[model samples]
Target: MKKARLWSLLEDGRVQCLVCERRCLIRPGAKGACGNYVNVGGELFHLGYGRLSALESRPIELKPLFHYWPNSTALTFSSYDCNFHCPWCQNYHLSFRMPDISQPVFSPEKLVELAVREGDEGLSASFNEPAVNFDFLVDVAEHASKRGLYFMLVTNGYFTEKALDALLRAGIDGWSISIKGCKGMQKPLGNIDFYVPFRNAKTIKERGGYVEIVYLVVTNTNDYEDCYRWIIEKHVTLLGVDTPLHINRYFPAYAWRKPPTPISKLLEIAEEAKKSGLRYVYIGNLHNPRYETTYCPKCGRPVIVRNNYRVVDWKLEKRDNEWKCKYCGYPVPIKGEYIPEKKWLGLM
Candidate 1:
């Protein structure tokens, strides 16, 4: 029940929600496209503030963030409501449906306390669209950053420039923006424009924040080689060769009943990305053990070997708080405190 933080009033009695690219204009007593922000009597109010739907300590790899923290765990949280209505959404039950907001409210301080108690490396706003619950995320992130805990946003990267800037200012350590597909699909959710990754990646990189791109390759929708190449050329050429890319295998979920993306297609896309001179490309959702590991681009050696979401072995050496492969002295892109001596649970 917080007043929406990032919106403006229009002259025609409509309020514009500057949360995402939608910039939804809502009249009095009407909700935005996200379903979380409402124009209540000429004022904008956020509906999902302090309302959490799920919380857990999960492996960092489960966020599929291999380049950020290879083998650590993060305290993850998700609230109800999302800005985009992606038909293939896997978390529709929670994101699309309104939760019982009166169940219980956890303040930002309490959420930070829980994250610290769990001994997690960071906090991940995932499962649902964190942007829809922007107020809660900013509050929690501010507290977590003050306590030296990292903050991550597993978002669709469709946030408005102002909202995105505010999150970066609040000390967001990492961002994994899902690039759904190239432009011009049947629905709003399926389209991914060249401007999004190209623009957002530059912004994230300039802020000294880690940015990774996740591409969910549906069979006939966005499985084209040209789209993949465009992403590589745009991001890699503009950002850097070391920028991380996660090619996720899309399964039939929610309203999408298509077959799962084939392993061969995933491999081919990875190969295409590699040939485009991108260094770190990964395949997700499939059980190909070798594809899950991170290899040193310099010497072609497995620097961080993974078994699903678990780190089987780490052959990196730390020097001045940065990780580099001892074999060839090549810098590793991962960012986290390395606990080589601590034993950890294997991936489930």
Candidate 2:
């Protein structure tokens, strides 16, 4: 356990955690909403620090981050407990429970070394809400940067501005935030302001960090056409049309037993987003080569071809220090260097 960096002591043996928007006011000998923060002697402690529930090296594309660092792998991990109570959380095994201190602790330095040993391009805090592990992530990001590795978050974007600013200062390179729309439908998840995610996305972009939006379209829930339109408008106007937006197909999980999102509906939303002037829109989860491929905005040709979660082909060439379409010379917004030696399935 470690003393929380983003917390304050309150009057009468209480403390307030300022890591996320919840700002849980915890009493002595009590735990906070996420179950990872505890108040001890009028001080807040992060019990989830260095404790991990899941860890693996996975394709960065699987994060649905199509725009930032294509054909790369990240050493991704997550801890237990989440501030939000989403009934259909896909990772409920981790998010719905209290942080298990019994879990093996991996120090920030050890994690960064593991990433290096695994030959990963970066480290990602994912699986469950990462705000609970803010201090740990900051430490890991610092260590990862020294080793020439990037650090990022796959989050719900419910962080306090102070926490976000701290993350940026810690060298966070990118964010793939889930923006679940429909305020009424989100009541199950504590009715968190749906606009906050959009606002945070804009903030990340303005701060010069790579960002991608992932909207999980649950069946009959926040699947309305207007939701897609609103998200498209925000993506186009706030983050710019070139920013990548992922329309993910949601399946039955946890308490929510609704059927999977219709593939046709996802395709329709993607088409509509394209027509709305968004350049990079994709359908995730239910994979098809057509929906996963990244097409050049200018030449209308596939710049990167992904089959499932693997990059099968890369058609962009580095010229003038920018990734440009080989045929049309249209500059693509992909960040990081292309690891040409990295073995790909169907390298073009």
Candidate 3:
């Protein structure tokens, strides 16, 4: 166990964790709602540090970040434990159980070396919650940025402002915040309820970082049109019309056994979001390639064509170090260098 860096002592020897939005206050020898942070002897420590539960090289598309670094592979790493225990969590095993810390330790330097050796375009902190392992992520992301490698975060966006501030300063390139439900849905796992999507979205955009919102449309739970409209009004409206919104179809996973979200419902919600002035919206977990590709909102031309997880064609014209469509003059929402290399193409 490692002493957590983002915590403080409270009155009467209690300890307060400032990692996620929960702001869990714990008494001596008690664990917070996350189950990984414990107040031992008046000091809070992160129990999951250095406990790597999962690591692999995956296509950037699996992260579902089509716009940021399309057609590239990323070295993804994750540790066990998450601040929120969503019933529909896909990776509940790692998120809820304590990770086997006996796995070989890889320092920030070693991780960067692996990413370069594998010809990876970037690094992703995913599979489980990365914010719970903030210490390692911050250090590794800083090193990756210096080497001109992209850094991505697939997070729940429950992080505190302080945690977000540290990551923004560390040069994270992209972040995808999952929006499960509004404030009125059934209580979140662990009985902890609090997620302000609008506030979090605003903060991420203000930092000049790439931000995407993922809303899991669970059947009969949060698939209402009103909730979809609320998300667009609160999160996407202020961020401009170009922000990417992913409407993922939810299936029975982890502890929940609900039926999969219907394709009709997904399309209905996507249509509603577009009418709300959202430029880019995509449907996930289905076999429709048309809904996955990105088009130029200005001219309605297909700028980036995607075949499942692979990017088939890119119609971007580079001038003055910016990407613009060749057909029209509309700007495409992509980042990083588009080097011409066959190795990166095969991994897409």
Candidate 4:
């Protein structure tokens, strides 16, 4: 166990955890909303640190971030417990549980070295809400950067600005934040504003870090057409027109199992988002080669061709230290620090 960096001592032996939006005022000898942070004798402890529930190499495409370093592998890992209890959580087994004895403990440097041994040039905090063990991610990301590996986060975009500031200071190269539009939905995170994620995404882009967004379209939940338009408008006006936003289809899983999002709806939302002057809108989760490929937003020429998860071909040219489409010289917003040489599916 380690002391959390984002906590404060309160009166009468209560420690306030300011990591995610929950901001739990944990009482002494009790865990917070995530069930991982504990107020031990008037001080908060991050019990989830180094206690990994899942670890593996994940495709950047699987993160649905086609614009930022396509086909790059994120040597990713996550810890137990989460800040939010989303009923449709896909990784509830890890996120909604405590650290078991069967789980192995790994230091920050060890994880970076593990990625190096596997020839993976990217490291990510994912599979669970990374806000819980953010300091650990910072240590690993800072160490990984020294070894020429980029760092990123696949997060639920429910963290506070204080945590975001720490992550950027600790060498986070990019982020893939999933934004939920329905603020008043069942069990919505407390004290979180709907516009906070858009604010955070804009800040990341302005600070020279890559930001890709995902909106998981769930049936009869947060899958409204206006949600897509709002996200598109924010992406186009605030982030950039070329900002990559993925409209992902949500499957029935975890607690809220209604039905999978229709593929036609994803296609329709993608089209509407694109028609709103936003480039690089993609339909995710449901497989279709036609929707997976990246085309030049200005010229409409295929720049990166993807089949399922593998990159079939790339038509980007690096000239004067910028990646641009060869067809129209339109700059593609892809920020490729390092591309994985081996197939991640084939064990890179």
Top candidate by TM-score: 2
Off by over 4 Å in 2: 183-186, 341-348
User: What is the C-alpha lDDT profile of model 3 across 1-348, one tens digit per residue?
Assistant: 778878889889999999888899999998887677889999988776666777788877777887787788789988887877777889998888765546565688988898999888889999888878887788888899999899999988888888888888888868887887765666443343435545666788887888888888988777776667777676655667788888999989898898999899998999888988888899988867798898888889888877757777788888777788889887887777653432434422
Cα RMSD (Å) between model 3 and the true structure? 2.3
Q: All candidates' lDDT scores?
A: 0.81, 0.85, 0.80, 0.79
Best by lDDT: 2
TM-score to native of every candidate shown: 0.94, 0.95, 0.93, 0.94
lDDT for each residue of candidate 1 in 110-215, tens digit (9 for 90 to 100): 9898989977778999999888888888888899999998889888888878888988888887888888766455444543354675577688888888888888
* lDDT per residue as tens, model 4, 132-183: 7776887887898789888888887777789888888788977898887644
What 10-residue stretch in candidate 4 is worst by lDDT?
182-191
Higher-ranked by TM-score: 2 or 3: 2
Report the Cα lDDT for candidate 4.
0.79
lDDT string for model 2 (183-232, tens) is 54544554577777778888888888989989898787788877778778
From the highest lDDT down, the ranking of the candidates is 2, 1, 3, 4
RMSD of each: 2.0, 2.6, 2.3, 2.0
Candidate 4 lDDT for residue 190 = 36
Tell me which of candidates 2 and 4 scores higher on lDDT: 2
